[model samples]
Target chain A: MKNSWLALLLFVPYIALAIDTDKAFEDPEMQARYEEITAEVRCLKCQNQSIKDSNAFLASDLRREIRRLLEEGKSNDEIYDFLVARYGEFALYRPRMSGKTLVLWIAPALLLLLGGGVIVNIIRRRMNMPIEDDLQEPTNT
Target chain B: MSRFLLPLAAFVILIPIFMVGLTKDPSELPSPFIDELAPDFTLPSLKDPEKTVSSSDYAGQYALVNVWATWCVGCRQEHEFLMELSRSQSVPIYGINWRDGRSEALRWLQALGDPYVASGFDQDGRVGIDWGVYGAPETFLVNADGIVLHKHLGPLDATAWERDFVPKIGGGS
Candidate 1:
């Protein structure tokens, strides 16, 4: 009974590690393209998960669509265009810079600059102030 | 006072943005096909595979193209409203029976009330991808020019129909 329990625990991990290979292409290059696209495409059903990681029906359908597009000799940009044309820019995990997304792309750098300005200002102000030796406790002299 | 200026301005700016975002539905994804020509497709009619259904059928009139499946609970919830719309005859309701077993879909229409003028059997949901259908119970409004005007995700109710669809079609319905 103890051996069976140990075997069951081992079996659980194997099931979790099982790779989904049903939608793979015959060509290695095409399969790599398939993997790349699926990983980058956001599953609409589960907004945070990539299509490659999601088990949603919509994700599976998108995988099938990617396979078909690859088989049709579509380039990466063309495939992205196809998805964006239908589902909008939100479908892509890495969104391209556009009019609406200009701020989103630059916000992090902008925030860093602002933070750096504040730090510099504080440091400069501190340098200008005289040190107060009386504020510190007298050491055992 | 100077130290607080940046945060105060950010608060002022972000307040309205957050308020606007809160009012919007996260699940309601905006489709890119709006005001563009609807994707053209020729599919087999769900009821009788011998007959064909095409996008051109909606030309010369405004129509509702609803994507549904037997497995979608939202589709079932909105079914009565669809049947009611069909009976009123203001606009024809077409269906894309997406990614569903044919027999089960046929039985659903029979059991509930058949609202669609013709439901296209999209066996593998390939056509659905063209329509930007991520989930069931999505309704597209196509104008007489065959341009897709609006896409409504989730079950259609009287409130949604009046608020969204009615104005676009010009309040007569």
Candidate 2:
């Protein structure tokens, strides 16, 4: 009887500790979605840090809000819509490729093509010219 | 000719090993949570008036740093875990108290516990902002190299310490 009571005494606190463990592992689907949205959201306080990377109170609250929303069965689009309505489009880490963002999306490719064209044109001009004749013509002139 | 063939064969055989090593698991990339260097700042130490501490203060140690404010209830909820972790590991624990009254912070540390080696008082939270801290009770595991190796967004607990952190870093459970 004493041994059983001793085991019970030891086991009770451990069992209580184990009860709290579920908080860390609870709602796998919700947790995964929480991660996705946090990654997508930008932290306003930190320069260019995603909510996932920030440890600020606002970021933490936002993350908890996301988790709560997910637990309430809100879809990713719905969560994003809620955030956009509150914080505007700047809340997203990857700004959408829309009309206003078209420049942001296209400018790099356009610049690359322009640069390549200039280089190719210069190379072709150099190749087409007769170097020896060009030098001789300049000297003759 | 034989030497060249052997070298070529060795190169061919080693390619797969090299590729496997280079293509590490995405999950293992040190969650953007605490992958970067912890931001540097010298804040007044809560315990000592004249002394100041910064990220460089823990340069040669494997430190678990927690950011919390006395006003934050979540920090209180995670208090036991911090105490447990401190007791369990030889690693040092440091705290950055963000935007809280200095007296309350000191009182809380005195009442609940003081697992922290030193606590920084970030009165304005500018240092917290620089560290990318959005909330209270965010914890970072910084390697000896001063690179943040892992981050726990919410409260810390035994299960998280074992499953997520210890296994990832090959530390004792």
Candidate 3:
């Protein structure tokens, strides 16, 4: 019992830290929207983490702002526009398709096609090369 | 031989681009509001809670809209510099007390000296969102025409003022 009690004490602090306890919308639809938007929004303070995953104060504030805007009947697109207007396209995890972002969207496919063409060309050239006769007498024999 | 060298040349070109990306601070997201008109907002004044201040009040002069909060450590770091700048009276300074307790914010200014001509209480940080403030201690320099001239992230000091603000204001200050 003493050992178990000590173990519980050690685990209690982690349990406290693990609980988010963030306020949730009463409406399920709004809550869903909140979750979706939070996931889509990048946490500027934690560049790699989504707003939903970040513990930064700015992320929390942004989440709260999103909730408020949702409550005010603002659509998801409007909310996104609001953030983009302020933080620029960097706020969006999936950047919108535009002239500036066209290269970013197309570069991977272009590289893949280029690489495939090179590999195909190399293989074709090797096949076209004269093959050494397997039945030829060993030169050093 | 030229075909093989093409990939090497491509990689060489990408090296500098990748280096630039790696050196940039990812947390410092660029504001889209640069060179655009400052967003309009009306918030209650920190001094007199009953009275409100609007963005229009900053019209007709170069001003600094400093976003700060009592909870933000960076704001505390930059407070002394703001106080000094306020003393210079070179330009009007406005405050957006973002998402902070009203009493605590008032107490902070009272203790440190109020630098803002009118500190707007952005108790909910909505105005701050409009201002494209991702972090506290971000300062925006707005021209007389209400257009945002420059936005400086992180703490502003004398060196930053000379480098970032002086050129925009034509070295007047």
lDDT per model vs. reference:
0.90, 0.74, 0.88
Which 10 consecutive positions of candidate 3 chain B have the poorest summed lDDT? B164-173
**Deviation in Å, model 1, residue A43 alpha carbon:** 0.9
B1-173, model 1: which lDDT tens digit per residue? 88799889999999999999999989889888998999998889999999988998888899999999999999999999999999999889999999999999999989997999999999988999999999999999999888887888999999999999889999432
Best by DockQ: 1
Candidate 2 chain B has its poorest 10 consecutive residues by lDDT at: B25-34
Residue pairs in steric clash, candidate 3?
none
Give the clash count for each candidate: 0, 9, 0
- Give the poorly placed runs of model 1, Cα more than 4 Å off: A1-19, A133-141, B1-6, B171-173
Choose 1 or 2, whichever is better by TM-score. 1
What is model 3's interface RMSD? 1.2
Model 1 reaches what TM-score against the true structure? Answer: 0.88
In candidate 2, which residue ranges exceed 4 Å CA deviation? A1-141, B1-33, B171-173
Model 2, span A3-119: residue lDDT tens: 999888876655343211124427676677777888899876564678787776567656766766787888999988766644445678776787866898899999899889968
Question: Candidate 1 vs candidate 3: which has greater lDDT?
Answer: 1
Specify the poorest-scoring 10-residue window by lDDT in model 1 chain A. Answer: A14-23
Q: What is the lDDT of residue A138 in candidate 2?
A: 53
Q: Candidate 3: which stretches are off by over 4 Å? A: A1-27, A133-141, B1-4, B171-173
DockQ in order: 0.76, 0.05, 0.66
TM-score of each: 0.88, 0.48, 0.84
